[model samples]
Target: MTMLPIQTTATAPVATPVATSTGDPALPLELLELELSLDGFSGDEASFAEAVRQAADQVGGDFLFDLPASGLAEDCLRIAALRVPKGENGAPTIVFALLDAEGATIRVENPDETTKDLKRFADAFVDVLQRI
Candidate 1:
């Protein structure tokens, strides 16, 4: 596994999660911040996912290619990536997605909602996203 180092500056304290109008999960502050940090490397969900997958394929290493939810938009499928942390203050994990570039699906997953698959793909090239 390749480890990408993340250094962050202090921000406002995280608030409690509230239900959204559509009843979809509300994004946590951590996930939101992660998305903001990766803005340059991100774009339309479908395009970003395809690019990441292709980049990983070119390197030809282990990549986790499972989608977390069923009924998710097929075009947007590959672009979504997430990582659930094991505890508070653990390596910052990300729940990344782009719905019409609106970020409607980025949120922490419930235990029942999670799949037996990785939340994101990993490779050394991921460093480019981090350093930028």
Candidate 2:
């Protein structure tokens, strides 16, 4: 199995503007989380990385970096990218870069997939965000 790098920095975290959702406490962040599942590939790591780059571009974010796992379970992969706009409180977040080798599945831990199949993951992510 191949491994990708994980990148996390200690830059000053920004606080986003408060946005109301369902009359609850306004989410003070302009964050958009998206997850996408891809199948029917040969499981090429390079291709996967490229796909990630493309996704980041589509979301107008830069390829901040990725982190690879260690030990016997090296097949599990995670990557993260970011997009920050001037005067914005927090950086745009894209995460949970998960790739499942056996299932040939690439799961993005974002919360913006509006498709029926991925609604569950999106909802779960939003729930976590609310609690944070």
Candidate 3:
């Protein structure tokens, strides 16, 4: 299966630590999220997410695979910002999520309110697949 690249003129994704009141804080969740309506893809949403998880791992990405029995759809993938190095900007990149299907969406830990980061990520992921 070939995936077509999508171009977006949006801002970049940034990661920030989530404030915690307790001693043990949960993992940081992405701040910026973008929705995508893709064409020419028909499959189960969970399967799509698993494929992404595998692809990300193949590309040396720090990804968290979703549990098959979790029955969760939104936070399916938690990955590192590939284009941007982790802890490059002083703050550690938080775990990000990507959900793809006929309609897809990407979530990242960024303060910017633009789709640029998501666009870059999507492009990068496609580029990796093309190379492999």
Candidate 4:
């Protein structure tokens, strides 16, 4: 399997703020900040699951696919997994999703502690998003 390298920067946090497309100017506009890494699987849920497993191994982090609570399904338009490693200060949890036939998206949550390494992880996630 081919893997891509992601790098994060301190100046810019790994977040993509998207606005809702609802055309209600009077209502408060909501913004969602998503920090994700993305890749392409073989357009199959099973393939995506395997990719997540490999990514976990490569990152030395625990991997989970189609977590029940995540509401991912084979028939759904898209599906993904949020991989959370073990230990108190382990790697940030990542959410890997199949955006479409040609691409997948991985989102990473902030670590419990605000450390430089965590920041780098966030940056890496951002880099992944950009590449995707």
Tens-digit lDDT track for model 2 on 1-132?
Answer: 122333423342221222222332422222232232132233545566666556556555554554453321235554333332212644444343445544244544332332223334434555566799
Off by over 4 Å in 3: 1-42, 65-92, 100-132
Worst 10 residues of 3 by lDDT: 32-41
For candidate 3, give the lDDT.
Answer: 0.34
RMSD of each: 12.5, 15.8, 14.2, 15.7
Count of residue pairs whose backbone atoms collide, per candidate = 1, 11, 3, 4
lDDT of each residue in 1-132, candidate 4, tens digit only: 122334545543332322112332221111111222223233344465566556556655444334321223232334434444433465444433333332333333222232234335545765676698
Instruction: Compare the candidates by TM-score and give the number of the best one.
Output: 2
For model 3, how big is the CA root-mean-square deviation? 14.2
**CA displacement after TM-score superposition, residue 56 of candidate 2 (Å):** 1.0
Give the per-residue lDDT digits (tens) of candidate 1, residues 22-66: 323544444434434333343444455554344333332222343
Better of 1 and 2 by TM-score: 2
Which clashing pairs does model 3 show? Answer: 10-116, 11-116, 30-108
lDDT ranking, high to low: 2, 4, 1, 3
- Each model's TM-score? 0.31, 0.39, 0.28, 0.33
Segments of candidate 2 deviating more than 4 angstroms = 1-33, 37-43, 71-75, 78-91, 110-132
The count of backbone overlaps in candidate 1 is 1
Instruction: List where candidate 4 sits over 4 angstroms from the true fold.
Output: 1-43, 67-76, 85-88, 91-98, 101-132
Q: Give residue 103's error in model 1 in angstroms.
A: 12
Candidate 1 positional error at 50, Å = 7.9
